[model samples]
Target: MSDLATLGRRIRHFRTAAGLTLEELGREVDVAQSQLSLIENGKREPRLTLLGAIASRLGVTVADLLDESAPSPRAALEIELERAQSAAAYRELGLPEVRATRSMTDEVLRALVGLHRELDRRARLAIATPEEARRANTRQRLRMQQVDNYLPDIEDLAEADVAAAGHGGGALTHRTVSVMAERLGLSIVHVADLPHSARCVLDLENGRIYIPPASIPGGHGLRSLALQAMAHLRLGHGEPADYEDFLRQRQDASYYAAACLMPQGAAVAFLERAKRERDIAIEDFRDAFGVTHEAAALRFTNLATARLDIPVHFVRVAGDGAVVRAYENDGLPLPVDATHATEGQIVCRHWSARRAFARSTRTTEYFQYTDTPAGTFFEATQTGTAESDEFSITLGVPYAQSRWFRGRESGHREVSRCPDLTCCRRPDADVAARWEGRAWASARVHAHIFSPLPQGTYPGVDDRELYDFLESHASAPEE
Candidate 1:
C-alpha cells in the first residue's frame, strides 16, 4: 500500500477508537466532512496543518499515523527511504530520490535498501565527542536503573560458569588466567598495542584473547580484564554488531568478570562476616579480593541488598564534580535533571562525591552525612589519581544502615537541598553578607547540555558522519 493509504488507515483506526464520526472529527479539526472522507479513503493526501489538526483531535501524533511498523516490510523500507531523502545531507550527497511505488523493480528496491542500510550504519559508528559520550553515559545510566541494575539471565550463567570452574574459594588471582585458559581451551596473547581504552579483545574464531602489556603488570586489573574476555566465551556472548549492543555486551562481560573474581556465595559470606564487625571498608574488601577500590565498591552494590540486607548507592565523580558513573539499589535521591541521573551532570557540591575532592590528601578517605528529599544518607568517599586525572568514589547507605558502616562514626554532617538555589550548602548567604557586588563568577557554559545527538541517530551523532562510518565498517571483522 502507499504511504497515503497506510496513514489514512491509521487515522481511521484512531478516529474510530476515539468514537468520532467523519463529521465529528471534521468539526473538531475545522475541516469539512467530505474532505475528511476523501483523505480517509486515500483519494486525497491531507496537508500538514490538516494532518496535525486531525492527529490532535484523535489524540495521536502525526508520526503515529505514518508509523512504518504498520506497513509491509518493503513499504516500511520505502517510507524510510522517503524520509531519508528529505534530509539536506542526502540531497547534498546527490543521491537519487527513491519513491514508494507498487510497481518498483526488485533491483531498484534492493539498491535503495542497501543505501538506507549504509546510511544507518554510518550514523551508528561516527566518533562521539566528549559531550556526546557524557550524554550517552547519562542515557545508559537511566536505562540501567530502569532494569534495576540486574540481569538475571546473565548473572545465572556467570554463576554457573564460576561453579563449574571451581575457582570460587579465595580472592581471584593471576592464576585464574591459566585455570580458565585450560578449562575453556582458549589461548591468551599479550600485545603492546591493542587499542586505546580497550583492556582486552577476544578473537572468537581463533579462540585467542589479546591483552595490552601495560594492563598486565597490575595483577588485579589484568586478572579482571582477562576474566571479562573469558566471560564472552563462558556465557556464549556474540560480538556486538551495534553501539547499544556493544555497551550491553561490555556490561554483561564486566558483571561476569566481577562474579568470577568474587563468586556470589563467597562474597555474601564475607559481607556477613564484615557486618558482625559493623564496619564495611571498601579498601579492606579490595585488599581481600586483589581488586581496585572502585571494583570492590561496584561488587558491593551487586551483593549489598540481596546478601547484606542493606540497600546502598555508589557514585564515581571526576575532580570537576561531573558524575562519571553511578548506581543505586536504595531509593536515596541523587540529584538528577529531567532525565535520570547518570554521568555529565555536575553533582551538588554538598554531596560527598564532590566534597571528597577537597581533602588535604588525595589518598585519605572522607565521610559525610547528608539529608536529601528522599532521606538521610551517610556516605564514605575516597579519592585516587590515574593518568593525572583525579576521581572520587563514594559508597553511601541510608541513615538506618549507616550504623553498620565504619564511616558512621564520622563527625562530618551536612543537610542538602540540592539542585536548588537556596540549598543550605550554597555560599550565597556568605557572599551577600560580604562581597556580593565585588565578586562575580561568570556562569560556565555547559556545552554538553546543548550538544545532544541529532534526531533519529544515536546520542551525539550527525547523520552524515554516521553514514560515512557505516560505509567504512561494513565489512569489519566481528571481533
Candidate 2:
C-alpha cells in the first residue's frame, strides 16, 4: 500500500509541474475541486479510477505517482516535516504545527525535521534507560518461563511455511528458504552495503529483504538473518511502540528463525527418540540439525520442558564470564543484578559456564555438577568462537533430571556460594593483603553502559541510510 501522504504529495507535485491548478485538474478529471483539494492535502484517499484520471491529467503514470522515493529533495523534506509534526511526541508539545508552504525554505524544513528527529530520538532513549531495560528483560524472561519458552503459534506458522517450501526434514536449505520468501511475494537480495546497524533490512515498499552478501561469521548465518527478517512479516509486527514491544518483536523473530531452522515436529520427534535411548546430547542435536552448539542448546530449552517434561536452563557466557544470555525454569540460580537482568552479570566462577573457559580442549563439551545456594545443576558447556569472541554455551537441568541426558556420569564437580561476598569475589587473604598496598590496576569500563540506544525508526538503525539503500535498489533489476 502506498503512503497516502506521500502519494498525495507526488500528485500535487506533478500537477504544479504541469502548470495546472487544483480546480483545473479537478475539472479535467471530472472530480469536485474540494475533493481534489482534500486529496492534495493528504486528508483523503482517492479512488483508483479517480487516481488514474488525476495521473493522466498531470502527464504521469500511476507508478510515477506511487513511487516510494521522494520526487525531489524538497518534497522529501516536506513529507518528513509533516510526518514529524503529526507524531504523538510532537503533538504532546502543544505547539502549533508549522505547515510547509512555498515561503518555507528548504533549509528551514531541514532544520525542523532534524529537531523533531532529535526530540524523538531522545524520547526513545529515555524509555530505554538501563534500569528500564533491565526490568523489561526480567519481565520478558518471566513471561517466557511461564510458557516454558514455547510459542506454539509461531511453531505452527514455521511448520506450515517449511512444509510449503517442500522441506522433508534435516537442515533447511538456502534454496528452500528462498522458496518460502518467494511464496510470500518477497525477494531475498544479498547486498554488500547492508546497513551497519541492521542484520537485515526489509524493504516493504520494494518487496525486497536486503541481507549481507557474505555469510555472517559465528553461528549467525545468512539463512538465519533472512528468516528473521521474514518473521516480522509472518508474525504481523509493526513499528514498536516502546522498548518492551521492541524486545518482544525481536524475541519473536529470533524464535521464529530458530523454529524454521529446526522445525518443531521433526526436532521434537528426534529428541523423543534420543531420550528413549537415554542418549540425549547437545552435540548430537547440533550435528543432527547442522546448527551451532549455542543454537542447539537454546533450542533444547525451548522444547525440553514443553514436550519432554524435563525442565532445563541455558546460558551463554563471554570469555570474561559475563552472562550474555540466559533462560531457566529449572531452579538454577543464575547471576542477576537488582533488576534481575542476567546479561552482563558475572556468573559464578565455579559454574560450568565459567569453568569451561579454563579447559585446554575445545573439541568436546565440558560437563560439570555445580552446587549453588539454590541447588545442584548438571551442566554441559561448550566453548565456541563467534567472530573474535570466545563464548561458552551451557545447558543444564536439576541434578535429578541429569539421568535423562548424556554426560551425567562425568566426574567433574565444583561448589559455588554465589551472591556471597566470600565466594570468588574476594581475593585470597594472602594475595589481597600483599596486593592491597602495592598494586594498582586500571579498570576496563564498558562504553555501552553509558551510551544511549541507537537513534532511528528501528532501534540501532540509521533510517536515512536504510531509505537511501532502498531507493537505490527500488528500480534495479531483480537478481
Candidate 3:
C-alpha cells in the first residue's frame, strides 16, 4: 500500500482500537471531523502540535506507530509518515481551511466546562486500582449469594435522588433523562430485581452505572438503563456520587429526565392497568415511549410484569459481540421470537462465543423452512406451557446495537466453552446451511472461540425505551 494509505490506516486503526469514535476523538484533539478523516485517509499529514494533541488524548506515544514492522518499500513509507508526524510538519503541510462551526455561546461553554469538572471530580472518587474490580466483583457475588430473591426499592431511590441532587423539581421529567441518554448513548430505563445499593465501575477516564436489577421498576430495563447511566459517565455529563447515593438520589433525576421526554402520569397509569390486566398491546408501549417496535417489545416485557404481576427475568450482556439483552427463565420459552437474523447467517463468526449465549438451539443453525437452529440449547429449568401463565418467559435481545459486543486480546480460552460447534467452522453459505443436518458433522467441533475483528463498528444503542416511554405518556381518544 502507498505511504499515505499505510499512514492513514495505522492512525485510524490505533484511534479506533482505543475505543473512540471519530466525533469523540475530534473533541479531544480539538480538530474538526473532516480534517481528521483526511489525515486518516492519507490525504494529508497532521502537524506536530496536532499529532501531540491526538496522541495525548488517545493515551499513546509516538513509538507506537513504528512498533509493528514491515520489511519493504512499505516500511520506508511508514518511517516517512512517522517522521512527518514526529516532526509536526503535517499541521503546516495540510492546507489550512476555515469551516462553519456550531455556535457554542460562551455561557454554554462555561456551564459545560463546570459540569465536566464536577463529573471529573466524582469519577475520581470511584477510581481504584485495577485489582479493585476483582475485589468488587467478589464482594458483590458474596452479597448476592444468598439473595436471589432480593428486590430493590425504586420509589425509595427516586426519593433519595430528589433529596440529594439538589436540583430539586417536582415529579421527574422523562424527556430530560431521555435527552441525556440519547446524547451519551445510554439506555435510560427502570428495572426490577436487584440487591440493594447501587454501584458503578469507574476508571480515571469514565464510569459505568449498575443498579441492583431488582431495585428498578421493570424487570426489563436492566441493560438499557445501566448502559445509559454508564454513557453519562463515559461521555462526561453524569453527576457522580457514591454508587449508593447516585442510585437513590439520581433515580429521580433520571425519572425527571424521562418524565420530561415522555408522558409520565398517564403512561404510568395505563401501564399499571396493563399489568393489572396482564395485557400487552404493542401500540400502547410504542406510543408511550416514542421508541421503535423492537425496543417497545423489550420494554413491555419488563413493564407487563409490574402492571399485571407477570414475572419476567432479565439478563443482559451489553457489549458488542453477543446477546445484548439476554433475558431468560430457568423455565418455559417466552412468547416472543422475532429476529432480523437470517438463515445460514454466520454473523458471530469473528466475535466471542458469548455473542450467542442464550441463543435458541432452534436458531443455532437458522431455518427458513425449519423452525429452529442447531446448538446446545437450554433445557426448561422450570416448567410452564406457552398457553398457560405457568410458563417462564424468555427473550434474546439480538438488538442492532449489540453488533459491538466484541472480545479483547484476552478471552481466547473462554471461546472453547461455547457448544455451538458449527459456529466455529470457516463460514461459507453452503457450509452454514448444511452443517447442522449433515451426518458427518464434527463432534470435536464442539466449541469455537474467536476475538472481535479490530476496528469494528459499535453503533451505540439509540434506545427503544425512549419512544415507548413517551408514547405511554400520551393518550389517544377512542378512535
How does each model score on TM-score? 0.65, 0.77, 0.27
Cα RMSDs, all models: 13.5, 6.2, 22.6
lDDT of 2 by residue, 180-221 (tens): 899888988888887677878888887888888755432348
Question: What are the per-residue Cα lDDT tens digits for candidate 1 across 1-479?
Answer: 35675676678778988998999999888889998887875568888888888888889898888774644555555556666777776788886876667699767887887877787667655645545544556666667656666556766776676667666577765665556766787666666555443456665555666676744464777777788888877767764544555566677789888877777777777888889989788888878877889999998887787667788899998887888788887776666655454566677778888877777876657889988877889999989987897899999989999988887888888777776767744567766789867777988765756754433333333445545443443445424
In model 2, what is the error at residue 77, expressed in angstroms?
15
Separately for all candidates shown, the number of backbone clashes (residues 3 or more apart, or on different chains) is: 7, 0, 75
- Superposed model 2: Cα runs more than 4 Å off: 1-122, 214-220
Candidate 3, residue 408: the lDDT equals 13
Is candidate 1 or 3 superior in TM-score? 1
Worst 10 residues of 3 by lDDT: 452-461
- Top of the candidates by TM-score: 2
Per-residue lDDT value at 106 in model 3: 45
Best-first order by TM-score = 2, 1, 3
**Residue 337, candidate 1: how far off, in angstroms?**
2.6
**Off by more than 4 A, model 1:** 1-120, 126-148, 214-218, 239-242, 362-364, 424-479
- Candidate 3's TM-score reads 0.27
Worst 10 residues of 1 by lDDT: 452-461
lDDT ranking, high to low: 2, 1, 3
